[model samples]
Target chain A: MSKVKKNVWWLVFSLLFLLVLTVAISDQYYLLVSFLFLIGTMVPLYSRFEKKKIQSREIVFLAVLGAIAAASRVLFFAIPSVQPMTFVVIVSGMVLGSEGGFMIGATGALVSNMFLGQGPWTPWQMFSWSMIGLIAGLLKDSALLKNMRSRLLFGFVMGFLFGWVINLWSVIAYIHPLSWLAFIQAYIASFYFDLAHALSNVFFLWLFSSSWIKVMRRFQKKYGLLD
Target chain B: MHTVLNDVHPITSFCYYIGVMILSMMFLHPVFLIGELFLFILYNICQHNGAKMKQMFKGAWFFIGVIVIVNPLLNHQGTHHLFYIGRNPITLEAIIYGGLLALSFCCLMFIFLSYNLVITSHKFLYLFSRISPQLALLTMITMRFVPLFIRRLTTIKAIQKTRGIQMDSGNIKTRARNGMHLVQILLVCSLEEALQTADSMEARGYGVKKRSSYLRYHMEKRDIFSLILGAIILGICIYGKLKGFGDLQIYPSLGSFGLKGIEDVMLLILTLLFTGYPLILEGREWLWWRWQK
Candidate 1:
């Protein structure tokens, strides 16, 4: 009981820390604040996985699924910003729980950037993709995400959100004395790529998400994974 | 791998890269950032003999060009009006701000290129494994699987090409659908095999005790020295930035570009040391080799 209380306090503290970091992004220390925000949110999630008594099957499954997501990014490189990584992460969240979903999204970003190139954008990409998975998993049992229509809608909105959040690294760090005009201009500049990403996400989720979820659910049941 | 920077502990090198990256963002003046850009580019050349540097430039120039070209057009808040493209007034201060943005980004790009070269995957995983062994193990397995999955993807694509689903032979929509189909197949097959791999790991008693690293990197004397030097230089840089030395205020009005004080000169020297840390280390090694010859 005391341990549970301790864990609750930790959770509250981290959430408050994340809120503070998010507010602090508008301060002069843009890069540092965003980096702290990513670390603050990600470390708690990752540490929870560490503290748990996870099965080998769970770890291997998450790794293989994340690799699949990363490889598909490389495979679909011919298309510009039209990868199915978001679809895979969302589907994984629906099948597995939030923890499982967060692992896949985080590893997907880290590993794909391994093959692509690592830059200042890596942490932002990791944060954005992981949030997609976390939110999807959190809302998995909800009636809003119960049907196919809303799920695809979630994917579409997440696509734009991913682009917008990723663009923050540049807009926050590089844009001087940030104003709404410059901020809107940066978003406007990325509109074409973001639209393509959103459309591709919808397309993949609409056509293949059901089967993918079924396949993952079957594996989870067979292996008694992430239970 | 045997170079001076890579020879130091990964934590030292990691701290070095982080220091430079934060400095790049902090120093928002054109002259300071451009100096950083040149130092990092020279460091890249020293790191990889100009091959990776070329690739870095190829990938970076587009975004750099975009920002430099776009900032002036969008930001019309500055007072020194250069001219009017249509009714929009582009200012000299805005142009300088754009160039500063581009230079900082270019510095970041070069810094990352050197980072990847210096801190290889084994060291990266090792560093993180100390923090959280589970996440590090997961990352290792995922990194190992990426190349294997890419290879399996090729095989699956070839096999599927014998069937009706071919990415190249389709229209845009069809091609994307076919590509996703290929990925779905890869997913189903790999998820099954991954369970077997997991069983194999359990059979081998994977989590019976604390995880031990195969590639061990303990901090040595050189690492300590480098870390201390890095902290000192970083301290001076941040101290100087807090005093409003390295960064230029260019939003409401442009700050003077000339170094107007002794503290400014000191800050410039410290900034040089901060950016050129790795280059100096590697250059001294080269000179030592020549002296021995």
Candidate 2:
């Protein structure tokens, strides 16, 4: 098979393996931890073989990412009213592309949980935050940030969507009521935190996005990582 | 240091850890809390494995802090007065309850740390292989890679700092962007590592039928007894729970200790035994080693 075909096959196999393993475990904590490790290991591998530049700086970048991600949890505790992780996901997506963004967001949760300790709630948190990074990276690639208005608008929408998605997990794990009212209550409770994230995203895009793109381009040139 | 930590079977230790975790989640029984605290103190002071105990406690402090902060917030109601902030009231009952929860969490962590000390990953793999080969494989792989991912993350961060990336104090946006930059790099690195691991696993014929595990543990008479006792304790706890012996209630009267009657005492004893089985095994091993000395 061609290299592309080989990578794709590997991805498919690994993902299937993960799905089967998740189902088999039946314990959400084990499944989440297993997934985090699997993804943490797999994401880097995918990046290396994607005919990307293979930057030497990538390792350093990831470590810093992990620390920041870990720190975000502490920040959440410090300021329980805001969700800093959402902002982290968006920024990661813009810099690393979708796959990279997803890995960091997910793995960051895993690392945070190590200190926070594991529980049934981790898998949902991992998936929810990861989707944020993945979506941000995808949106960034699509030129949603071309203008200030569009960038801010996208940020606001993404922030609310992120909140809504995570709230879905809360509904599943807790709130056995599972009614529309329960959903709305969960959403409303999350709104303030989500609003913080959304405003932060817009501000982030306005302030450092151009510089971020420039840095990525420079890093790519210097280290020949991901074209 | 080595002898006291080396006696318990990994599976027994794992069971003990899981039992404690489940109990911590299900009920905040004060007896169990007290029992666990006493056990931790005993293990720390008397186990003859001072270094191991220190490490366990050091690692535990952060979790303790988390429990302290989160438990109060989650369980908002309690009777005894402490103070009140606006609508949210902090009660003495809540503080005591939170403290118990923290103790329970520490007990779970203690069990896990003890397991790590007594049961090497290789031993854990061997024990699991007998029951489920795929799960055994996955467990081993996860244990192996989690640390690697952490190490790699650290390396990535150091490298970024050297690259003159200003990661420190900025506006929320700048900080977030910096964080994203680091995450992007980490992801790329992780993907590379995963590919390498996959290649290695494939080369080694990991998923092949009839994989062999190096078994080092034999089921001795003591092991059998311990296992039997564990089964009985687990059975009784389940039976008692089903019978509504310790069904936690946080309502009107804040339901006075569920385990009030004689049957409740029996359930508490069984639960404590179940939760502390590993420590018991370890204690036995420590005694044996001391006698030999």
Candidate No. with top DockQ: 1
Top candidate when judged by TM-score against the true structure: 1
lDDT of 2 by residue, B1-293 (tens): 45333555656556655666566545566765676667755654454656765776785686466445544544456676466677677655555555665666666555555444555656656765665443344334434445565566567778888886645778865766676566556545654455455556557775455555566666666666777777777777777776877644543225665467888787777776665554676677768889999
Count of clashing residue pairs in every prediction: 0, 15
Task: For each candidate, give the interface RMSD after superposing the true interface residues on Cα.
Answer: 1.5, 9.8
Query: How much is the TM-score of the A chain of model 1?
Result: 0.90
Docking class of 2: incorrect
TM-score of chain A of 2: 0.67
Name the lDDT value of residue B239 in candidate 1. 85
Tens-place lDDT digits, model 1, residues B174-206: 988888888889888998888998899889998
- Where model 1 places Cα greater than 4 Å from the true spot, the runs are A1-27, B49-52, B73-79, B84-89, B249-255
Per-candidate TM-scores read 0.91, 0.53
Candidate 2 lDDT (Cα, 0 to 1): 0.59
The interface root mean square deviation of candidate 2 comes to: 9.8
